[model samples]
Target: MFAYYLNKTLMHIFYKNAALTDYLKSINIQQTSIGFVPTMGALHQGHLSLMERSMLENEITVVSIFVNPTQFNNLEDLAKYPRTLDEDVKKIESLNPKIIIFAPNVEDIYDGKPSSESFDFDGLENQMEGKFRPGHFNGVGTVVQRLFEIVKPTNAYFGEKDFQQLQIIKKMVAKKNMGINVIGCQIFREPNKLAMSSRNELMSPNEKQEASLIYETLLNAKEKFETNSAHAVTDYVQKTFKKNTDFKLEYFQIADEVTLLPCLRKNKNKKYRAFIAVFINKIRLIDTISLN
Candidate 1:
């Protein structure tokens, strides 16, 4: 069975603004410490883990599953992105937390108008995901900002798999000076060590095996990090993946964790990490590892 039981009592889904607001008001949400976990549907274990953490830390947990359209630079990718609302609701309900599922429609979120607010991440946008996917972070910022306004949660949870996105959201919260704490949870990985992602559903079994090489490469880089220079480690990873015909390596950056800037040379004072994006069977996958 997809879920142990369809516990309708635990899962409350809202598509309109008024109804959600009324319910939250009736429940006295303003008086409680609310934890918000925002997602783009196609729920996975990584999402569940975030919910579990939120539940442990806050009195009430709210999860939003709106696939923000503005985040997708490629129209086809946005179109192909998975949307399993029935299964997603089932998975969240299985957790048995009294969670509010805010699956708002585009019209409801945008209010029949477009989100035109621009965010300056101050060069955070010039890095990996931003450098390639133009205007992606803007969409992320817009939707997340909107959600935070609507939910008014005390704490927000995000997975570390999207490390850059996590940082961007934190930046957004800070810029807006919203009274909300942004928490970055650990990245959940599969048995083979490949970082779990909603996009994994598109991968065939053989393709999934090929994708594991991305993490394997990161592990290899981490080992080399102990003895090699940052530049040398990057070159090695690039050359190694170039030989593999299964996937095409987009970028492998060894960068400072906070600044998100590529490291010229390793500094013992600062923490460094390796971020990678690869195209496997036409689906783009990203993974990161601590080089230190």
Candidate 2:
């Protein structure tokens, strides 16, 4: 039947270590360059773009669709996080039937313990997102490190929308000497220039429309950053949000891209990015813009 072959084409999806392990063993690992794109499983254009890039650049591409519980600091968020495995699989199948999928459960990843292992990213974990969502980077580091161990991909792709987390992940890779190529991809945006996120699924039309200002404000801050101090730019972003009653500003900082420390004074030689978080109703959204 048509459904049988369709299902067979999707058989590359691995739910257990043995399935993925046996599949990988069939390939020539040393000779093949594997590209990995890991996601929490709401397949947006942003996620698909990463997978498309991986397929173009590598001999093989693997996409992991796991809703990482340890990564969520809030239990309610974990409960509300979207699980679109059926829809996600179809997207991956349409993208490339050959691309492998790793849809693991907590037991497969953490042996069911489900706790974050603390990591010292040289205080990189203490600032920005870590400052507000305590143990977030630790959950991130733990899950990512464990996934890396299990998947053993040659290169891993991450979006720059989570710019701070990307930097911390890079630091973790370097400190741990993982030897894998940690690649940072550009932030994928919506029609209104809002960075695409899984949390956007939880937003109402008005909330998403209002959330568009977050990126627009960040872009404005980036333009002002050329002639202004980081402190002034932060103030400008803060003032912009204060005028608008919709988005409650959480935190905003223009920081060194390498260190992620809020740069009060701009250093022309160093790379800096404007990072921001805001609460649009119950949904907390974060976005960043490069300030050269």
Q: List the residue pairs that clash in candidate 2.
A: none
TM values, all candidates: 0.95, 0.96
lDDT accuracy of residue 99 in candidate 1: 77
1-292 per-residue lDDT for model 2 (tens digits): 0121355574477888777877777884577988999899988999999998999889989889999888888999999999998899888888888888898899888897999998999988888899899889889999899888878888999999998888888899999999888888998998888899999989998788878899889889989988988878888988998998877999998888888887977677999988899998789999998887
Top of the candidates by TM-score: 2
Per-candidate local distance difference test = 0.87, 0.87
Question: What does candidate 1's lDDT look like per residue over 1-292, in tens digits?
Answer: 1112355354578887777777777786446888999999999999999999999999888899898888888989989999998899888877854677888888999998755478899789889998899888888999999888888888999998899999888888898799799999999998888999999999998888778889998999999998999889989988988899878888999989998999897789999889999998689999998876
lDDT of 2 at 101: 87
Question: Among all windows of ten consecutive residues in candidate 2, which has the lowest summed lDDT?
Answer: 1-10
Model 1 Cα RMSD, 1 decimal: 2.8
